[model samples]
Target: MWHLAKAPDLADMEVMAHEMFALLPEGFRKLCEGLIIRVDDFPTDEVLEELQAETEFDLLGLFQGVGLPFQSGEVSGQMPNMIWLYRRPILDYWAEHDETLGHIVRHVLVHEIGHHFGLSDDDMEAIEAQVTDEAAEMPLGAPARSG
Candidate 1:
């Protein structure tokens, strides 16, 4: 199969991320209005330094911008919330793991979205569970990647 020949690139991963986000519950999606999703092959040098990552693969995804609970009307020049998906790290993870790429993408998206809401780990787990249950009802398919 052509899939065996190459890994999905940044654009391909972006499509997968957006599709997965669309599959999330409407309430959650509404809460995330104006959120942006972007995919890159690796994190920037600045990000690596900031996160103190030992390796580029140390992070699979990241959430940037202020969380809802921390926002203040007095604050100015705030940026929109964003979720970043790293394609190379995610692909490397997929190579080592048994789960489908769709599942991995969905999990990362949910985790990052949780950050936007400033949800605790337990709450995040509960949200993830809801996604898993919902996904079981209708499986999501990963988009095909083009070289």
Candidate 2:
């Protein structure tokens, strides 16, 4: 018999995102060296408007800033790339799906970053396969009680 803990909060989800990033293939991770990962309960009104989201749950993750392929020596002081994971939306997704929370987080992370890098569908699929396998062996830690 196994005991499962409560659902993760924003902080816990952030940690999961970091772990998932670290577990990606070295070459893929190298491309995202300075990438930032963040978690929020919901996208801000500003962000939602910018992305043309129909609802708060519509966006699970987002990639911001210039992608590597678009970088040029002519441009300077560009903002570092960042990935945002929406916790409430993700949790809602988890509740409705048959997959683990870790799997969902990893999927969102890879999909956002992969697109930013202009990776092909096959490339993303390979990364997804690896992440799913690794996440299965990893424990979904007991999240702290949200205040």
Candidate 3:
């Protein structure tokens, strides 16, 4: 049977995601509540079926379930909002792109968590711009990288 090589453990991904999140402005993390971050090597066949993916390499991250805005009255127990980062896909992206691994991880984290809060690409861009502006306000000699 064909199988993939070893990947980063779940704990490591969680820690990596959190570290990237912390680097964002304080308010950004607060906006996403009960959003669970999960990491897996590639999307499962079930996910491919659900997402109508034609190939395994088609996805890097996925946000499962609905966002908060759509909820109405009388909501009972339900699954928490979740973002899945496909490890192999991310590693593939890393290899394909010239960006640093930390930046790629941060990009994945931001986009996936961005979905949890119902943020659009434009919205994410604005947030990114704001973070960039804030970082520029730091000490003159020392500069903070966007990663």
Candidate 4:
């Protein structure tokens, strides 16, 4: 089974992120109405420089744009808030740790979404716990798809 296993690619991670997002509490999901989620192999050079990351693997995921609490009225050309999941780094971390890929993806998703809500680490942890509990209750099968 190990020999047959392959690391998830960008599209796979994107689906995982969306599935994880769907697993989150309904109210929490509602708060993320206009949020966009994307996955890439790694952080871009500009992103690494701007975040002062020592390497592409240094950042697992990122939340870009102003958080809800900081938003004033809409600007003329403001970009929608986005969460970027660095696939390679996330895979690297998964290989080094004992956690499952789904767990790690859920974590990164929650953390970035937390930033969108201007939530603290503690708040995110609570949300993670809720998601974990809810997910465990769900029957094992295909992940929920977003339309």
Candidate 5:
């Protein structure tokens, strides 16, 4: 089992996020080099307002950034890719479902990042099969299970 460091005022969700990131294959990691992963207790008022979320826990994860395939040679400056993991909803999911925490984090992480790359479910599943110990044992990380 993977373990995260313990620190004061630290949200375990962040640790889970990091662990999930580490579990991704190196090939996938190389594809999302500048992607930012963040974890918060819940979506802020501003974020909620923008997403038009009906509740704080409505969203589990989000991807906000320019997809690489969309960029062209003329591109000079562009925004970075980012993935946000919602802690409250994640915790709620773990509590309500039969899945494990690690699995949940990986699922959310993969869905948000993998979807951005336009990867298909079959592709993700194939990759997951190649790295079963990392993907299957941890569970989640697929588009449908993301968050």
Candidate 6:
């Protein structure tokens, strides 16, 4: 069984992210409406440069677009909010950490989404705890995919 295991690919991570998102508190999920979550092997060079990251793996995920507190109804032509998960970096972190893949993905998702909500680290940790409890109560099954 160990030999059969392989690292998750982009699509796999995307699905995991979606499933993790679905497990979040309903109110939290509601706040994330229209937010796009994407997974890539690594962040683009542009993103790395803009963030002043010394290496591609230095950043695990990123949240782009104005936070909720700064949004204005008058502003138009603004890009939709997006959260990017860097697969290679996330996987690398997973390898070095004791956490499960799902746990790592959920943590990164919460962290990035927290940025969108302008939430503090403490708030995000509370949300993560809520999600973990909710997931524990639910029967395990394959979650439906969503865009």
Q: lDDT value for candidate 2?
A: 0.82
- TM-score of each candidate? 0.82, 0.86, 0.73, 0.89, 0.74, 0.89
Backbone clashes counted, model 4: 0
For model 2, how does the per-residue alpha-carbon lDDT over 28-85 read when each residue is reduced to its tens digit?
8888878999999999999999989999999999999888898776467778789999
TM-score, prediction 5: 0.74
In model 3, the number of clashes is 0
Note the Cα lDDT for every prediction shown. Answer: 0.78, 0.82, 0.68, 0.83, 0.71, 0.83
Query: Between the candidate structures 2 and 3, which one is better when assessed by TM-score?
Result: 2
Pairs that clash in candidate 3:
none
Better of 3 and 4 by TM-score: 4
Q: Please provide, for model 1 over 30-128, each residue's C-alpha lDDT reduced to its tens digit, 9 standing for 90 to 100.
A: 878789999998889999999999999988999998777877775667788899999999999999998878788888988888866877778766765
List of clashing residue pairs for candidate 5: 107-141, 108-147
Worst 10 residues of 4 by lDDT: 133-142
Model 1 misplacement above 4 A: 2-5, 74-76, 132-147
lDDT of candidate model 4 versus the reference: 0.83
Deviation of model 2 at 57, angstroms? 0.5
- The superposed Cα distance between candidate 1 and the true structure at residue 120, in angstroms, equals 2.4
Scored against the true structure, residue 48 in model 2 reaches a CA lDDT of 95
RMSD in angstroms between candidate 5 and the native structure over all alpha carbons: 6.6
Candidate 3 CA-lDDT value? 0.68
Runs of candidate 2 with Cα error greater than 4 angstroms are 1-4, 132-137, 140-147
Query: What are the per-model C-alpha RMSD values against the true structure?
Result: 5.0, 5.4, 7.4, 2.9, 6.6, 3.2
**Model 6 lDDT per residue over 69-94, tens place:** 88878578889989899999999999
Q: Tell me the deviation in Å of residue 109 in model 6.
A: 0.8
Ranking by TM-score: 6, 4, 2, 1, 5, 3
User: What's the C-alpha lDDT at position 9 in model 2?
Assistant: 76
